[model samples]
Target: MNRDKDIYVLLTDTGTVLTKIIRTFTKDPLNHASIAFDEDLNEVYSFGRKNPSNPFFAGFVRENVRGEFFEESMCALYRCKVSQSAYSGIRAQIQHFEQYSDLYKYNLAGMLGVVLNIEWEREYAYFCSQFVATIFKRSGVSLVDKSPLLVTPGDFQTTPHLELIYHGKLHDYTGCEVTAAAAGGSFRTA
Candidate 1:
């Protein structure tokens, strides 16, 4: 991966009953976080509902923005420029989990920690934001000052180095020019 190229952070409100309940507590438009290797974001990785119809069956999910599965979701797309080494580390970590996805499980206990304002982790289990947060931290790219176990999808909105490039219906997002204003150009934060 080239440092000059853009990597994406995807936040989505999938408009499910479960997401609605999470919304009431977080009071934010986002309930999920995913990372993408390419700016086009053909495939996005995250810890989310493996079966979209059932919120409980979840682990590492590879999402498609333009697919029929996400037709009703809203999304915020962000771009960040990271060193090639950082990007490689991030991708490698994601791939590691992806390769052994069967061993991973949804962290319902971790989500309980969020409600209780406590932090906890289970072996090979993760929620959406924590999964992404861990990837960033493992890559030596700290996106938030908080602990990865305590991070939320909304927290990424305040990330100083992350550029808010697009917010719209996921179905409408072509992923080609996620940052239509900058268009193929990405900036680094000091």
Candidate 2:
């Protein structure tokens, strides 16, 4: 029998100038979106800035949510239940992106399309929400009833399929044991 597995969608507002600008256009608290394979959010992926200090250089990234970048981020965690096969497909899709990460580029123009309510498709290019939506689409899972190109981080919250599990400072999240480490490691020096 095929059982269901839970996948996570993390929406965050990092307070960066770019996110601030996005929030203005989106009118939402969280403007960035990421997908996590586990409840602890240890394995998270997104099409976002590869370097914390540089927003221009971006693409597929295996996000370190526990790292300093997300320490003070305001975020919402959502859970989506999928069949075992769909979970495997999602895993495969993420793994494929990880393997060819260098070939991908951030879809800057697509962001404009999102703001203009148009669909923009580019080869091997994706913005955060597009990437997350594509993952579900390619995995044969229906996340939202809309085009991936036009999906916004706030759009995920409106979907009935996703359950909001937590909403607060990313570091203060105590939904799992990982929060203890996140809370403790904040002020510690390496």
- RMSD to truth, every model: 4.3, 5.4
Candidate 2 lDDT: 0.87
The local distance difference test score of each candidate is 0.81, 0.87
By TM-score, how accurate is candidate 1? Answer: 0.88
Could you estimate the TM-score for every candidate?
0.88, 0.90
Clashes of each: 0, 0
Query: In model 1, which residue pairs have backbone atoms overlapping below 3 Å?
Result: none
User: How does model 1 fare in lDDT?
Assistant: 0.81
lDDT of 2 by residue, 21-138 (tens): 9988999989999999987788899999899879888999998887788877878888898989899999999989999999999999999999999999999999999999999988
* Cα lDDT, model 2, residue 171: 66
Best by TM-score: 2
lDDT of model 2, residue 13: 90
- The weakest ten consecutive residues by lDDT in model 1 span 180-189
> Residue 148 in candidate 2 has what lDDT?
97
